[model samples]
Target: MKFAHEFKETLERECFPDHWLAAAIPYSQLKKCLKKVQRELESLGLDKETLQQLLAEQTVSPNGEPIPLVRYNLDHASSRSLRPCLSIFVHLRHGQVIDAALSPASRAFLQRLSGAHSRPSAIDSSACTTPLATPSPDVSSDDNDEDTEGELERIEVPLVFDGEFFNILQTDVDSLDALQQQEEKSMEAEIKSLGAEVSAVVGPPKRLAKSDLNRWREIFDLYVNAQVFFSSHELDHGSRSSVKAVQQLVWFQKQVQTRGLLQSFKVPSSAVAYSRFLQLNATLLQNLKFQEINKTAITKILKKFDKRTSLGASVTFRSAIRSRNFLAGSVAKKLCAQLSQEVVSTVPRAEDYDCPICFSIAWYPVRLRCSHLFCVRCVIKMQRENKKHCPLCRDEGVMNADLNNIDKSLEKFMKQYFRKETEEKQRANEIERGMEIFGDQYKHSSCVLM
Candidate 1:
């Protein structure tokens, strides 16, 4: 999908603040904004869903009628192939006031567009002759040949920006280029200096004289790569100092894997140890954006490997060699955090909003003293069963805690984020209530014994 031309114009004219433009305007942010709008419209006792259905029914144009565009790309949580390619399309009516409070960027963008531009297209009709984007032809058409079409459908999004935003971006790009050039020159000088130092070492063995220089170069380059990954130069010396141990382990592993030196180094491949290593790597990657990694934990793995390596290799030949910061500056850490935690789909993760015991979207959710959340009904059931501990935490006296004390914030989060799930739960509850009041009609046979 491509954003409408008017939408682009709206964003440019809005001149949203910088922070609002974070994460490059992901589709989730746009949907969240529209959902809030839907909620607000619902608050006025006008069902937007029903109104839209009526609008579609009454409208004369069958094919070209405006329809709500809400689609998401669902990918596995751990998939690396996912990219921010989803597009949004919104149609604004005249005098429709949009509040820019959903996100800093979204709010400012919409508010600016609403205030500056009143028309559908800000550009002159003669300059832009392309008609408004119609619904995709494949949607309603009966053509089977479209399935065999060789080319994938493409969306062209035009770059739109006013003078001030363009100038700011240009300046940042210029500064980054200059800094990169300076760093390259500095690194080149440092490498030459190190080479000179290696030559100056007196009484060095022949291995150190010839073979070791190449080894040293490889090791040095690995360190350079690690520094680049961590952006060590941008960090203060103290922060850089803390990562030294981790940096060394990363450097050593890189050398062994790249040079086929694992055999020479006698690195172990015990199943248990390798399993621990993989586990640690997965955890580190997942929480890498928010937490300082477990340096001591990594050190333990290396030490174990070092001890095993000294014991020498087994008689059995193994040919394969496999290779694989917690927070400072929390605000920046948080901004980077989004790159790691992606929403897999429009539907929220069930585990996040559901009660562990009931396996349903929690109603009247309450956080225990131990911070585990469960619905009020579940808590009551626990109390009635003479349970004195929290089902999740097993904390004593949890049943004595007030059931009326609800986590208002978490409730709001569930409502906003899990709208579809909540609606499904609500419908189920209604059916259950009807069955309880009227008795289950299908519980017994309907045949009479005349």
Candidate 2:
């Protein structure tokens, strides 16, 4: 299938809002412009073969150094404009060939361009500096400007469509960047508002017997387990693709429904907050799809441009066009970070307060001088064993922590957010202590016959 057709169809099918649709790259227009670029190059007798040979032509200096005869750069004069400069090494004398390696056609083309019409210019040592993998080398490396012969002249090829093509692309990229910024600000505001709304719905327990806080905690736990947009697994550590994001999002929604998490929302506002949260995620996914398709369009057009002109524009164009959120980073990565900091942090999770040594709630949490927390029982055992260093950081603060190390605030926090888990950990600690003191057959007093 033709990429242009596919691009057009996908744009229409995506049903993005009218403004977003309008802001998308004009792939068809760029394609038409690309044809002009091809024609313009061909008009100057610079077809794919001619240009490729010219670009690759090199000559050896008297000191046995290779001097590039031709250099092409997509000189970024400014962020708004990108121009292509083709600098060729040519002898000023009448008919002396600069490089014996260049074919007759390439040699003639170079002579013709270097003759009268094209103005001679010097290659700026800083002009070609970019992050390109295959950039044009700085030819002004010799101590003297002149080689053995009557000096080498540099010619700049004046190209119309080549510049036009990049201008169109770069302008679209800038526009898309602006749109993305606006969308990001809008989405961020929504996320912030949603965080507050969710916080209110799942706030600290109040007069209401069923305040929906526990339900929210459960929902957030499942949402976290879902790992919808990003994954932390060793196998897949980066942002998931839009398709994978869709699948994960669906799984999260299904889990909530299957577990009747939403159905059990005691607070009336909880349902509204949940609905808003789901919609925000959907919007992010929609933006992801739009960004992905447009990114594909840009790649296709650049590849086509390179294939048609043999100018090797794909690499140069990518380096020349600079964008912010649109072409650089994923919205998912940014928004997900914000979500974790703002929204998810509102409903405290048990993992955030777990003892590093036991991987469980740190009831009677003892905070060491190193600032690492551990369950009181684990610390007592460590002190009895004469273990001095902190388990996690290997700091010598473990022995320094005495009765004063017990974090009253953190203990209250654990009890408030993870009451059930903290209570169970306390019982487990009591059972272990009893078993250690009175053989394995001994049980905690709470479970023992009085």
Candidate 3:
């Protein structure tokens, strides 16, 4: 009980009764009751040494009483009979302190203590007591009254302890600060490493070459002009006015050539050849009035020039007599036939009715006020131009158009047309190369056989 007083006081000072408290006592006893018991024990001259020994032998009670104890014997003939023995010596010295000794039965009973119900009773007054000794009034009543209070106090302690309870509460504040410091150091190291890596990876951006920069500027200008031409061709009056725009493009190409704009860059041989071919076509167009040359004739002239150049042949006649006769005779007849066949093959069928400019076939081929079909490509081309008037028919005003509203059929037609055109071009090139390798030998063999 004296130990219990110190234990309960420790619990209270630490606010042990609160739900938040983590530490707790294991046994039952209130601080007030424990203090009273200790006072009674002291009054009876029961010193700490004597009290400890009595407790060890299980002879002492909560109220400081010593008593005889009993034990059960299963080895005896009568298993139910209580076995009695004296292991503790009670020194009943005259005028000396009554030093109580625990009997063997008492010692055995205490040693066998296990469960809650197996614990010995707290009050045992039937021990060896002198006739002159009387029960202390303060001890008897106080023990009974405080026993109830002690039972309630015992309930205050938690049944289980959470070992990390304190650590968890402090983690958010303390742990974060520590983590931030560590992260700061790590980030500083990472930044230093990154700076070194960046320096090693890229030595200052290289300056642009004069020739390269000029070439880029020319290409950019050409791209801008192409975009504008295509866009204006899409407007309501685009088709009719597109001829004048094409004329301007032809003029621009000539000016670029004559002014030596291309000389600034090291143009590839293939590119120079292609450019010359385009210039030849442009010259032909310039000579023939726009109204006199039909689309079929124009397309034929361009293709003829392209084929002649691809096969390494001269495009022009050496004499005026040869030119005039060829134009007016069988040569003309042959050229027209080839032109007709090529046009028929290249242009989609009326049933297919897709715009050559735009790969779409759905729209009712509405000729723009400029006389251009309203196909997907037409609209895209017009949008690119961003001009107020149609490229083909600038004399007639323009009309606003939205590409999103274009027919789906037209879109499908354009896609298929482009794909087929690409395939045909690839096939044509292969055939041309093959002929170049074997055409002369085949012609010689035919002459020998003849």
The CA lDDT of each predicted structure is: 0.38, 0.78, 0.34
Predicted model with the maximum TM-score: 2
User: What is the alpha-carbon lDDT for the whole of candidate 3?
Assistant: 0.34
For candidate 2, report its TM-score: 0.89
lDDT by residue for model 1 (299-400), tens? 232233223222111110011111111111222233222212321111234455788988988866878888888876677668878898877768976566
The parts of candidate 3 lying over 4 Å away from their true place are: 1-217, 226-237, 240-243, 254-260, 267-274, 280-450
The C-alpha stretches of model 2 lying farther than 4 A from their native spots are 61-65, 91-109, 117-151, 206-208, 445-450
Give per-residue lDDT, candidate 3, residue 316: 17
Please report how far candidate 1 places residue 383 from its true position, in Å. 2.7
- Among the numbered candidates, top lDDT falls to 2
- Sort the predicted structures by lDDT, highest score first: 2, 1, 3
Model 2, span 280-323: residue lDDT tens: 99999999998998999999998998788767778887776788
TM-score of each: 0.24, 0.89, 0.16
Give me the displacement of residue 441 in model 3, in angstroms: 80
The window of 10 residues in a row where model 2 has the poorest summed lDDT is 128-137
Question: Listing every candidate in turn, what is its Cα RMSD in Å to the true structure after a full C-alpha superposition?
Answer: 31.6, 5.0, 41.6
Report residue 173 deviation for candidate 2 (angstroms). Answer: 0.3
Q: Tens-digit lDDT track for model 3 on 1-450? A: 444354445445543224212212222322223344334434433334443454354333335545432111111113222111112222222222233353344323322321112222323233211112223345554573454222100000011111121122122223323433443354344334433332232221234512222342343355334431334444532322336546656665766676565665443442443354344334323322221222222234224422322211112111101112212322222322332233222333333454554453424333554555554345544666765565555633334555435445654554444444434443544454456778844332112653
